[model samples]
Every structure is written in C-alpha cells, then in structure tokens.
Target: MTKWSYDTNGTPGLDSVHAHALVCVTFSVYILAQVLRRQVRVTGLVVTKFFMIHVMNLAMLKLEAGVWGLVFMTCTLLYFYETLPVRYLPVQEKVVLITGCDRGIGHNLAKQLDQLGFYVYAGCLQKGSEGEQELVRNCSSRLTTLQLDVCQLEQVENAVNKVTNELGNKELWGIVNNAGICFVGNVETMTTADIQKLITVNYLGPVNICKAFFPLLRKGKGRLVNISSNAGLAPVPEMGVYCASKAALATMTEVWRYELQKWGIKVATIIPSGYKTGILAYDKQATAERWWRSASDAVKEDYGKECFYAKPKTEALLSPDLSPILDALVDALLSKSPKAYYYRGIFSRALPFLYLHLPTTLGDLVMKVIGDWFISKPLALQKSSKKF
Candidate 1:
C-alpha cells in the first residue's frame, strides 16, 4: 500500500473549495424555493425574498471556512439522511387508544388511523358531543368511541378496564396522550385556580393516562405518543403557565422513554407549532374580562386595568394543516424504530435549534423583540376608578 501525506498548508485545496461552494449554493437554492412556495401574498413574498437573500449571504460566509467546514457539512447531511428512514409496521393487528378524540389533532389522528385499519379506540370527553357524533358518523366498524376524562384517575382506570376487556387476547399497541388545554395570561394576572386548571389538563392528564396504560403498552411492546407544544421547548412570555405545563409533560415523556426501553416500549414527544385548532380559537377577551373582575384592588392597580384586559393581536403563524402532526403521530406509533422527539409544523425545528444553540442573552433578546412586535395593548378596556 502507498503511504498518504496530509496537507500541511493553511490554504484550502481546489477540491475543498468546490465542495464548500456546492453545499452553500445547494442549501441556499433549497431554502429560497421553500420560502417562495410557502409565502403566497405580495407582502409575504417580498419579505421572504429579503430573508432568503440574507440566508444566501450567510451561506456565502461559510465558503471561506475551508476544508473542515465542508467535512462537517457533509457529515451532518449524512447523519440526517441516515436518521430519517421510513420503515413502518403493519397496524391491522394492532390496537390503539387515542385520548381527546372529540376534536382537533386527536380527532383527525383517530380517523386517519381507523382508515389505515388499526383497531382504534377513540377517547372522547363527551359521548354525545358534536365532535364525537361526527366521529361516529364518519368512522368504520374498526373504530370504537369511549368516554374518557384523562384528568380523573377513576375514569382513566375505567377506560383501561374497558380497553382491556375489549382487547381480550390482543395487546394494546399504542396510547396517544392528546388530551390538553391552553391558557394564555401573564403570570401576575393568572390566578391560582387558572394555573391549577392548566396543570391538571395539560400536564397531569398525560401522567394519569400513561400510568394506567403503560402496563398494556409494555405487554404489546408498543409506543406512547404525547402531543406536546413548541412552547414546551422554548418558553414564551405571557403564556408562562401553559409553557411550564407542556415542558413538564415533555420532561416526563423523556424520562419514560429511558425507563421503558428495556420493555421495547418506545416513547415519542411531538412538539407542534401554532395551528388553527379549538385551543387557539378560545375567547381570549372573555377570559381576560373574568380575570379583571376577580383581581384584588391592590393587584389591579399595579398592572393597570388596560394591561390586564389587553388582547394580543392573534394570527395563524403556521399552516393549519393537521396532516404533518397526524403523520408524525402515526410514525411514532407504527414505525419499527420511531424518533424520541418529533418537532412538527413550520418553524418547529428551526426555533428549537436556534434556542438551544444561541447564547442565553442573544436568545432572550430575540424573544423580547418578537414579544414587542406581536403583543399589543387591548383595543378596548372598561374604565375603572378603584384604587388600593
């Protein structure tokens, strides 16, 4: 064999330069195409084009970093590709239980899985609610609807018993912990009761459901799919309680993943970005009014009546498509090897990456700027003369 000599010169070889250039150009093109396709309005298009130019400029800056940069880039691409294989297991023999099937992602996922031939047990909070009724109307014989309140331990046990009785010799393959609630308010404005409610529904609900169903999952060598939020990964101002609750659930899921691996029970946490679901459609104004009315005179004076009542201007930040989340959930459930963490929706992956990589000060500053731009004072507030 011929001996090889390593390059000792500081200057990059021609091959290295060409490789770096190719990577920069290819990535810039892909990003530009994504921006153009997703952004539809004239203003959005102009803004996106400007953003893409900035990204291209950053990409060009990597060209001067030489061989090491190119090598690192190549390795990253290879690792990403290797990790994202699409291997799925047959679900016809599997039995799945999904909570909060009365509406939103849970409703859609239950339907999709039912259609895919999984014996789906949908957990609805209300048996005869409009959403449950719709699910009943649309579903096939493979789908079964059960009344489930994840927050109540007795109800969770009853659901477990019902599913156990129904499953007979078949094992319970998966449990989708999709039941949750969202509460938006400043920490000062949010009452003890409000915080408790948020914690009960968003965090403890999953805990109760998972604990009851984990044994069955172990028996089946199945998976647990928890529907978390992007807020769990990166906390947002004014929605502190909601973020905290989701964060708790995420941490719990991670711990369970470590604990359950011995039994071949996979755990997946799905962190979705904003979607136009029932949670987002909540009447913020009415909630604000209720908080204002309950506030003590001393508490009211410090924050101001206007501040307490202010409704942040709401807009859909990401695509309303529930398909991505549903697909991710299915992959977590049925894939022979599922990802431990699935970040779904636009900006879901990017935002978390930035938050984890950026300096603490820089990340805080970025968040502050975003909060200032998006959060605004309420358009209307009832005048109050009361002072502590």
Candidate 2:
C-alpha cells in the first residue's frame, strides 16, 4: 500500500478516502434515480438530490466526463427499459379478487393484499377446509372469502353475485389468477385424465375466472395479474402438462392485454421459475408414490427418473412470499399502464432468460444437461447405497 500523506488541515487519510467514496456513491445513486423518472418522478428526484452535493464537489475533480457521462446516459436509458417497474403503482383500498386463495402463492398473495389495504375477495374450491378457514379468519377487515372453484361455472357465478350485491357493483381493482394444479408424471406414462385435470385447473380455470370478473375489472379500470411460470416461457422436462397450461395462460394474458387495453385493464403476468411451494411438495410426494410403480424395472434402471423429480431440493427456488408479489399485483392493479411480465427469485428469472433467448441448439443442450443432472443424481445415489 502507498503511504498516505496527511491532509492540509487535520483530516485523516481514511476520511479523505471516505469522502471520495461518498462522492462516487452519490454519483452512482444519482444515475440510478434518473432511471426511475418515468415510473415514479418524485422518487427519482429524491435520488437525484441525494447525489447533487457529491456531484458538485466532484465536478472540479480530474475525472473523465466520458466515464461518468456514460454511466448517466446508461441510467437514463434504463428508464426506457422493457422490464416491469420495481415499484409499480400506489397501494389503494379497492376491491380485489384472487383465485386459489387457500394455499401456496395464492394464500400468501391474499394475505399481503389484505395487509396493503385492498378490499380482498378471495376464492377457494372449498371454504370450510382447515387451511382455507384459517386464512379467511386472519385476513384484513375488508376481506371477503367465498367458495368459488374457477372450474365450476355455478360457483364462479355465485361468487360474482355476492360481490356485485355486497359491493353494489363497485369496480374491482385487482384480479389474481392464482388457481393452478400440477399432475406430475412422465409423458409416456401420463394418462389422458392426468393431462386433462392439469389443463382444467391451470388454464381453463384462469380463463373462467377472467371471463367472470372481466366486467368488474373493466368497471374498476384496474389490472389483471396472472400467475404464470418460467415454464410458460420455457418448457420443463417431465412437466409437459404443467408447462402447456402455463404457456397457454401466458399467451392468454398477452391477448388480454391487447384486448382489454381500451377498456382500461392493465395486464401483467408474474412468470417465476419453479418455486419450493406446496405444489412442489405435493408433486414430489405423489411422484414418489406412483412414478416408479406399474412401470417396468428395466425402464426405471435404463432411463432413470427425470431431473424434475429432484426439484423439491432445489435451493435456488424461493418459497412464495406474499409480500413482493402481492405488492407487484397491487401495483399492477393500480398502474395506468403495466408491463407484460414481472419476474422474481433466482433461477425463476435466469433459467427462462437463457431458454427464451438462446439459440435452439444451445438451449436444448443446456436444458438437456440440467435434465440429466437432476435426473441422474438421485438414481446414482440410490444405486450406490444399494451396492453398499
């Protein structure tokens, strides 16, 4: 290290360095603030103010304008970036409906929405289920839980009737299509019934809810947040059915944006990678019980289980936190305009990014390798254990 010379006055060497670092940090934060100008003007201005003093002092420094200018310009351009805003719209107390409010991401979302001061209207297949009842009891004062299986037209209609009657045809600020089901099995082994049930629960269920609630949303001039998946954007091996439904849902969300924009319905799809939610646990338990059964021992030995069979232990996966997503959903519901998609968590984003943008061959190679990695490890471990 170079020996530090004393300051002209009494300031220490470390203090000078700290001052310089503060200037650099201030400049950095100023640039970041410029990015938020379009989304939230006041917030961006606050960031600009944070860096002003440092930037003014540093203006006399012998730094190259090219470097700082480039940083500033890059941040300016980020305002126009295509991704969803980190902070969307302000939270407001407006009527909201969310399907699949019993458990998983939906349960978390409902709670968070309620906390955020929205008039939450949660829908479930059955109201009296232990988990469902518990959620209903603890929600905010404005919450209304109703038995409405999106798959059942009568139930959906009944729920709508209740909302219209109770709220007196008040507009709905948010609608979350969170209802989903997974049927895990090999494509070769999956029966028609398995695929059908998954499709009904994942795709048609959302569609039915949308159809029923579109009028209320239009009246409220709110947003639609669909809980799609990274699988919807990029396929998952051994999860063809789940992927298909989500893919369809993603497609439908896009179309809805196009269709409903004139009606003041902002649409957003939350596409996350596989989450370590109740869904994954349920699938893992079900897969363990039946995937290897009724199958030839030769098939199990030669082909082994799929990579997704080991997905439950995926550390990168985030458990559903109703806060961030619920915040996003509420924001989307209130935004005058919204992005097509919002992504969160770790692999939830990176995996889909690679799959969608990579060249077909390269993408296939990566996916195949991931597939083999997840599929092979457990089988290898099992075999080694057996030998011992």
RMSD of each: 8.5, 8.5
Segments of candidate 2 deviating more than 4 angstroms:
1-72, 75-77, 80-93, 291-311, 315-322, 359-361, 373-388
Please give, for residues 1-388, the per-residue lDDT of candidate 2 as tens digits: 2234455796535333434455466655654664556544345645455455355435524353433443553454344333334445666558888898788777777787777777888887788977588776787668888898888999988988898888764567878898888655556455456678889989999888888888888888888889988878777766778889999999999999899989977889987654555665565656544655645666567546552254533545555454556555655676656667777666668888898799999999988776553344445456788997
Q: Write model 1 residue lDDT over 226-339, tens digit each, in one string.
A: 988888888677778888999999999999999999998889999888676577656767877888888877767666666655354544454678887888898899777788
RMSD of 1: 8.5
The most accurate candidate by lDDT is 1
Clashes of each: 0, 2
User: Which one is best on TM-score?
Assistant: 1
TM-score, per-candidate, Cα-based: 0.78, 0.74
